[model samples]
Every structure is written in C-alpha cells, then in structure tokens.
Target: MQFVFLLHEDEAYFEAMGDEEQKAVIAEHFAFVAALQAKNAFSSGAPLAPAMTGKLVSVSGVEDGPYADSKEQVGGFYMIECADMGEALDWARQCPTAKYGRVEVRPVPDYGG
Candidate 1:
C-alpha cells in the first residue's frame, strides 16, 4: 500500500524561529527521511513554499493563492510505500512535523487501467 503524509504547520511559527532553531528542524527532517529510506519506505517528499506563493485554480478562474481559512497550512508532504495502514500510521507517528504540527496520513488507491 501507498500513503501520503501531509504535513501541516503554522507558517508564522516557523518564520518566527531563530536561524539555529530552523536549522535544527531541518536536520530532524533529514534524520527522519534517512530512517524511512533505511526501511525502504520512502518514495518521495518535499517542502512547499509559502501558501501565498501558490496559485488556486478553479472553474471560475485562477486565483492569487490557496488562501485557506485556517492558521495552519500544508507545509510539506511525504509519499511512502507501506505494508498496510497500520505500518503507514506508524511511520506518520514518527514524522518530525508531528512535534510542532500535524501529519495527515492518506492512502493512495490504485485503479486497474
């Protein structure tokens, strides 16, 4: 099974961090990724730019950004292959983002082509 971990966090919280704190947070993420790779679970992952930098496209028109009505925004994501939902949840629980933010684990369904 495949799962996607959506990392949500307050942009202001990260922006307010000192340089050292930010670096430490990044280091933690690196270690987490390394652990996933060692278990052959990591597929791909990346951090997203600020929400304001993203565009929102709809049937009406393209907007300036994905302005969600919430304090926290999706900061990054990780795609991993796991044995089952239980295994996926286990990995999500270990995500560094869970310390200060949230990790939403969603399964990716496959349809026969």
Candidate 2:
C-alpha cells in the first residue's frame, strides 16, 4: 500500500522565522527524508512554492492563487509505500512538519491507470 502525507502549515509563520531557524527546519525535512529512505518507504516528495504562485480552476474558470480562507496552506507532501494504514500513520507521526504544523495521511487508491 501507499500513502500520501500532506504537510500543511502557516506560510506567514514560516516566513517570519529567522534565517537560521528556516535553515534548521529545512534540515529537519532532509533528515525526515533520510529516515524514510532508510526504511525503504520513501517514494517521492517535494515542497511547494508559495501559495501565491499557484492557481485554482473551477467551474467559474481559472483564478489566481489557492485562495483559501484559512491561514494554513499545503507546504509539501511525501508519498511512501507501507504495509497498511497503521504503518502509514506511524510515518506521518514521525514527520517533522507535525511539530510545527499538521500532517494529513491518506491512502492512495489504485485506479488501474
């Protein structure tokens, strides 16, 4: 089975951190990836650019930015192979983003594509 860990955080809060603090946070993410690789669970993951750089498309047509009302934005994601939801949850708990933000763990379904 595979799961995706969606990392959500307050972009403003992260941007407010000092340079060293930001670097530390980035380092933590690297460490997390290393840990996942060690367990042969890592598939793929990457941080998204600022929300402002994204666009939203709906029935109303395309719109500028993600435009969410909440302060939290999706900061990154990690796709990992695991035995089951239980194992996926364990990995999510260990994610560094959980310390400063929230991690949403969702199982990936096979669509035969």
Badly placed stretches (over 4 Å) of model 1 are none
TM match of model 2 to true structure: 0.95
Kindly list the per-residue Cα lDDT of model 2 for residues 1-113, writing each as its tens digit: 88999999999989999999999999999999999999999999999998999999989999888697988999999999999999999999899899989999999999989
lDDT, model 2: 0.94
Cα RMSD (Å) between model 2 and the true structure?
Answer: 0.9
Positional deviation of residue 79's Cα in model 2 after best superposition, in angstroms: 0.5
lDDT: worst 10-residue window of model 1 = 62-71
Work out the TM-score per prediction. Answer: 0.96, 0.95
lDDT string for model 1 (8-60, tens) is: 99999999999999999999999999999999999999999999899998899
Best by lDDT: 1
lDDT of each: 0.95, 0.94
What lDDT score is found at residue 44 in candidate 1? 98
